[model samples]
Target: VQFSDSVSSLGIPLNRIGTTQGVTVSLQSCTNGVIHNSGWTDNGWCGLGSRMFFQSTGTHTIRAQVREDGFMIDQIVLSPVTYLSTAPGKLSDDATLLAARVPVLTSTVQVGIGTNPSSGSTPLSVNFTPNAKLSGGSLAAYRWVFGDGQISTQGLPSHVYQSTGTFTTTLVVTDNLGHKASNFAKITVNNPVTKPGTLTDTFSSGSLDHSKWLASNEPAPGSISGVNYGSFVPGNVDLSKGMLCLRLQQQQGSSGVMSVGGQIQSVVPYSYGTYEWIMRTSSTSSTPNGSGSRVSGQVSSGFTFINNSQTEIDYEIEGGHPDTVWMTNWTTVNAKQYTSATLTAPDAGFYSYKFVWTPGRIDFYLDGVFVSTHTVNIPSASAYILVNHWGTNNSKWGGTATVGVERFLYISRFTYTPL
Candidate 1:
């Protein structure tokens, strides 16, 4: 049995008239879906609602029950109490079997680019249509739940979705009877933001392209098609399968090789938009002077007022360690110097790499973790896509002479968006 009490009733007392029967009660407050308070209370695994939010002068339902052996004791006596806004005697003089009715409401929620919740990391908001009780009444309130296990106890819920994909959302409501009506909303989150026009490279099975990547390496002739790549099967990228890849086989080219990567480009140009893409690479070649002869890729992502030099960024996996990856950002059209970051990883596992390019801001990521960011104002310019295997020409990366016995820099896929 359940009863309604004053909104300010801190806690209501319930009676279960059985000594051996185990009783259980669950008090669910209107929330988004996160379990803050236990909602259960007892001396031993049945009483846990000592600190839930409750207002005064409002009706609440108290459910009482007796459990014999994990099952409810139907014949057991359950007594519950309730409080009301007005006197019970005057509920309605002509009312015979009064049933509580709430207002009918139409609700609508919105997400930025797409509807699926699982696509890319981005900001999203939810709004509801007008909601009011039938003519003389008003809706008590509305509550929402994020499939990721969060609760928003309000009429409208706003949130930044995590990652990308489709998710099922729930909206629950409570009226004066402690009665509830729930509705579900389907949402999909996708990164509709386009990528940098000059950035080239597709993910593969430990390599980029079908071993068709064009690279330059005289000191170490860069090989294209090999087995040690990221994608060994076609269509490995999607919601279910594998990730993108970029591979580079230790090259044994001529004495001084230049450009050494396979390039990919965007279909359109973006002046001051945010650009994003997830990348994975490992530096396990352990070759000599490997740092100078980078297994690197570059691009020009965004532009601004003084942004004259094309925005250039790099993903370099040198030959020295074959297990560490270095990322670099250049002031393509603004600042003249270049900024870079070096990170280590778990030997043979895949990690996510992200780059966000804006007018005065250039950010870098390693497996979604922010490592470095820059701010430089510059004018936009025509950018080109380029990837290379320049063998040890600059001392900035001078370490190994060769990129070890590795073959092919496999590339899986590329994505772009502003978050």
Candidate 2:
């Protein structure tokens, strides 16, 4: 018999069922022009190995001649050296059955799942990737369960979360040998506030609107802008006297005197817009002076913020300078431009403080009068609108707080009109 294939070796399965005579065989390699002879005698079943050294990988031929009649010869197997090592003898009449009886070595399949942007506001888009590893087998299939009643058969998939909830995404993979592996990842989605073309809040309802605002609650004692003695607590914010009040209070704790501040931020973000606040600071001075009755050592601010990027635009009134309102804009925390705008009566009554944020510029106004304009470091990213009242011990900035005094910043109205 002659055979031609693209292999480096062959496995010959032979069986002797009813004969005791030995069989002589000769294997001649056409490429190497070499002939090798061997005798097979004591074989109920066994795979005889032969090697052919071809200089390159291409078609080659081998010829086999049998010198006996009583011995039975099964099909010759074209295989590599590694496969022929485990090749078994004739197990059945089918050639495939003979190869199937060989024991194969394989390793466990491992699947790892990965997701990008795992948490965000709806409708959030997330990208998922799978890392599959296996030895002695190839990956055959991939299955994904997106945790939203949706399934996929793709190796890499992107999913959109339309509602608000935490979801567990799963990936299951199978190898060519039917070995399976699975992994999972968790994703969180939040409902975002609806964006309005124009908005107005008067605080006349006597309660903070849950749909529009979120009061800041920093219960951990920490510092902000070097004010190390206090934290911003949600309890310090309230609706009273037909206005939104942000209060600052001081109390003696085990560590010593501690302060609490108040803050509220808009739920939806704004980009180019006109933002306004009709507000006034609390007065500790009994006599009204030309500089107004604003208390020293406190800060009242209305600003726009992108927390992750540190982008901001500010209108801050520092009680240390009762008559000055700092107007500022920033592209980053390290990049900023600011100026002081003098106010005639910052604590006596409610006055409109507004900022017109447009492309390339931010124009500030106090009591509807144009105060200043900043053309440098104007933040281009959308940010949340926020107002806060707090006290600091930094004398040059907010000054040391009066230990027993309770301060407040009252806002009667706030509005935003998008441009």
Candidate 3:
């Protein structure tokens, strides 16, 4: 988007990053290609622990190539329009309430808004879409700030509302034309307000690393069950930093009576404990088409947690179901499998899973809260930790899925040192 060939500036963002730090910038010819030169440099913006830079200016056709392993550039637009000021639409008393995964406060009265250059009583309120993801809407062009007693360019921003009485807020906005406007969205920012976890758990050497936890593979199926377990994958399970990364590769064929794709177990398996794992699952196997006898990946076979006490406590997270997580614990009398919890979209991003076992009850947690819990210790036998990413008999666990091929659980930190 070249505005003026003589002098123009483009706003490009780093979409993704490769393993390397350096990125390459290229200039191509475009229809409006009458420029002296075009190139890109670091703009100096960082997000999610990623370091990136922007170019000073751009025109014609510009492309950025990352020299390193995991660098990706997104929205490399060549334009002359830069963000001058944002549209400070209706503000709120507080905006942070709607931003948290689990809102600490349940009331909408606490959301606040402030002006850019707060002057007087500004209308700091905003209208939002249904279910109000926050207190504001995308009505404004540039931004609809819920200010932080400071100036910000982002829209629908959240702030650390005051703890005592209501706070005086002023809402402000700047249009793309560099024109500025101001308003006051008032409400009370009182106590019981929460902000992003700004304070890391103060380290005193006792704080453990997030990559130290362990994970295991599933148990081998039996002959009577016709379950084959020859895919003994060593080095597939790893514990580092503080996470349990599980990666299993089951060969394509079965080993006759022995079977293929063996089930590996976790080195540290206990009945009663809290466990968290961030898993990314994908398979080299083909996805099942809806035509014939379908074949999905063995996501269930990808990762499994068993009761080390033999009570048959199991948390079988499979890609077979995709959205739902199946959990079951064995009963002392019968070793029948049961469904524990089935959730939605269980195969994306980082998930922190937890399992808690007591004398007669067992529980499972995803992210943080307990999704489902099973009462009565089943099996009554000794079990171990297992994480096996394998293929089923003709069609592995689901047969048509690929996320089960290489499964990894990135455990950040487990606070089993219960107080």
Candidate 4:
């Protein structure tokens, strides 16, 4: 038999007829100058294996010679040694033999993305299209990781970048054979447009509005004014009785006492605004320790923050001193200024607390009355509005927690007016 393409090995099927004794046959490959002599005692067909590596793409020949009179030749088979190791014994069909003889050609797998308008201003919406190619394979899945902590599994996905920054969007594709390929695109967003508007949430819906706020779930627990303790968890936040409630508690863990806290922050950053909240500090009345004595070791806060730079403006009440509210502002972690305002009844009911922030100064007001003003260290950057209730170990500041006790901070309303 002759082949125009390369042949790595040859298979010869032979049978013996009208004889019980063995019949011998010789199969020889002319390309590699190798011969294989085989014999079969039974009457049925049998194959002889031979190695004849043909590296070049040219004509190859295999010659068969009968060594016994009873031996009858069937058909010649060309196959690679690697394929014959896994092929069926009978060598039944032409399609199976063809697949074994022809080498599989595999091209490189690739993935890419096309964005509608790659760069734009803040609050930009862009549609994405995935371009993927795989030779002899089909794409099975698509995963998109948008730079701003968002992900999608759709092939064609649209995303809105709310803040101004440079984001790298990536698309990962998986083929049917479990091969993966990934590609990335850079998206630039700038020129933030601050629309003058008002945002008010009264907690009337009996649930946290996802459109405006995101419940905090910190990856690990951290210390604020004391020892390393619990972290902010979304499970601790509650919206009921037309108010937002933040819970602080201690639970028994395998490692010892584990503290759990609650927090929520606005989805979008605000700049130059009057931020107001009708809220009350956490008290011992909610704890097993009962009222009269303040809930120690806890700090309840309503503040604005830009985390990367630690720029902030805050109104915080220490559970150890419920009658005093700390008003502070920070341009950075080291540069800060603060003052204390006396509260008439910190745990009795919700009181109006507000701060008007401008580029030059920030003024604090308690129950519509002027409390304090900060002329220096006023943050000029846009920041998220956050409310949190957490425990600390600092004796002079947050004090020590009464283990297994729970404390709560209640807020009836929150309003933000663009200045």
TM-score to true structure, per model: 0.33, 0.52, 0.36, 0.53
Model 3 scores a TM of: 0.36
TM-score of 1: 0.33
Which of the two candidates, 1 or 2, achieves a greater TM-score against the reference? 2
**Across residues 1-419, which tens digit of lDDT does each residue of candidate 2 receive?**
33343233343322222333223333333222322122221121233533333344454555545556543444454444433433242222223433434334344898888776677779889989898888758888999998999889987899898999999999999988998999999999988745567879997797899898999987422344433467788887888556788888766555645778899988878878999999886565322222335566678888898865356998888767878889889876688999897887688877899999999998999898998889988787678888998766657887666677777788888999999
**What's the lDDT of the predicted structure labeled candidate 4?**
0.72
Candidate 1 on 137-178: residue-level lDDT in tens? Answer: 335666777676777776655666665667677776665444
The better candidate by TM-score, 3 or 4, is 4
* Model 2, CA-based lDDT: 0.72
In model 1, which runs have C-alpha deviations exceeding 4 angstroms? Answer: 1-261, 267-271, 282-309, 320-328, 332-334, 337-342, 377-379, 382-390, 393-398
Considering only N, C-alpha and C atoms within 3 Å, which residue pairs clash in candidate 4?
297-398
lDDT of 4 at 45: 22
**Candidate that scores best on TM-score:** 4
- Writing each residue's lDDT as its tens digit, candidate 3 over 141-202 gives 33443344544445554444433444544544544344444455544433332211211211
Shift of residue 196 alpha carbon in model 2, Å: 3.1
Give the Å error, residue 414, model 2. Answer: 0.3
